[model samples]
Target: MRALKLVGKTLNFEVESLGIIEWYIHAIISYQIINYEVLPADTKTPIEVIIDQLSSLSLSIDSKNLVSKNYFQKMKEDKLRKIYPYFLKMLNNPSLSLSLSLSLSLSSLQTIKIIIILDIQIFIKLMKYLKI
Candidate 1:
């Protein structure tokens, strides 16, 4: 989790355009951020606060809802989908974190599919949510 904080901080730097790498990073970090188990949220835990801010979810999962891990993943997807704009716009970053880089670098045989066949000029302008 601490490592995630560092990567998150590093990715926070301003970048005009993001690539597939950034998508993987944000997906992983946002996944961890959204799904990391913490307080019950009655006290409004930091994770819950972040989640609520991200996807407007209360994120107070009870024992009754703990049917299976897939259930959580499925539910998380709905919330995660709401949050990620190609990658969760994590504090305005939406870019690569370390763990994701490690995974991509460590693996070679993974088959890839890029569904978004975007025009070059429009791609750079899409991910950066900047005032300038």
Candidate 2:
């Protein structure tokens, strides 16, 4: 999870946004697969605060829920549904972390499907910017 920590550190997201997403990710990770001890820490523990924050973020992501707070609240209770399916696939197969991350990074060259896509464009830009 050291890698996740580094990535989290480098991310330029706002503090509030970071706090929100990090919590849900941690809780889902802890609940479905592993706990924080086995992974990296980006924000809080006990994880409830983060889970609570998720309700707000969901409103922005899913417009239909924007009308009522209850819609987003419901999503928070069902954490697994919020996790992108492709990400879970990657989590299920540990050997694919590098390959999956690399593929996500090259999304412009190839259409990404059936895989959880995250940070691909940002990764590509960072690599070029750093001359790596």
Candidate 3:
């Protein structure tokens, strides 16, 4: 209960991307509930206590990976790897397609118009191709 409340409180209610956030939250909660149910009652542990233990056991990745490539580069790669599976899962959700389709329509048109508008010579050449 305490862990659940903590997770709930950490959620940014004002953020515009609630659907993505909720997807992660529900995924985490489901994982926790399923694991807890499988564990024997005598062996069960509070989520906070488990988290605290894990925090204490945290190990830093090798500094060599950071020095040559920079920390942000490694961190970015790690974040992409972690989220890639979840992103694929989200792609399977039907409602998400609607938002993606709407975004793609504007993006594709905007990209073409930008290239034409930004290059007047190119626009004129294209018009000649059309005999306009």
Candidate 4:
């Protein structure tokens, strides 16, 4: 949870984007979850642990795929591929979706927008066949 505590000090750091902070938080939590916990963090153990701990507010296909790929490597040592399927099953929960959908709708906090946040100007020559 040391990484989670750094949320307050994020502005103090020289990071490029909020995503960098987010990545660290997720990485730390993933490291923890792989170590085995005592009780149900969610209705299913690790799934709830993941969403609550990692703030996985949404579960897009890419999000699910990315998470699976990440854990796949760690779980490979145990050769217990079953955990991946269990994780996916929890992500598929309809109730979980309903609850997760209630998450705060704050404006994105990305520290860098468009890398340089520039205003680009475009000049166009009129085309004969194009409508004005």
The candidate maximizing lDDT is 2
Pairs with backbone N, CA or C atoms under 3 Å apart (clashes), candidate 4: none
**Global lDDT scores for all candidate models:** 0.36, 0.38, 0.32, 0.31
Task: Give the per-residue lDDT of model 2 (tens digit) for 1-132.
Answer: 344445545764211111112223434444434422233333322345434444434233332323355543455433534343313333344443333323333445654332222366755644554455
**Which stretches in model 2 have alpha-carbon errors above 4 Å?**
11-116
Whose lDDT is higher: candidate 3's or candidate 4's? 3
TM-score of each: 0.20, 0.22, 0.19, 0.21
Compared with the true structure, the alpha-carbon lDDT of candidate 2 equals 0.38
Clashes of each: 0, 2, 0, 0
The model with the greater lDDT, 2 or 3, is: 2
Of candidates 3 and 2, the better by TM-score: 2
User: Residues 69-106, candidate 1, lDDT per residue (tens digit)?
Assistant: 23334545445444333233344443323222111222
Q: Write one digit per residue (lDDT tens) for candidate 3, span 21-42.
A: 1233235334445533322221
Ranking by TM-score: 2, 4, 1, 3
Q: Model 2: how far is 46 from its true place, Å?
A: 28
Segments in model 3 whose C-alpha atoms lie over 4 Å from true places: 1-75, 96-132
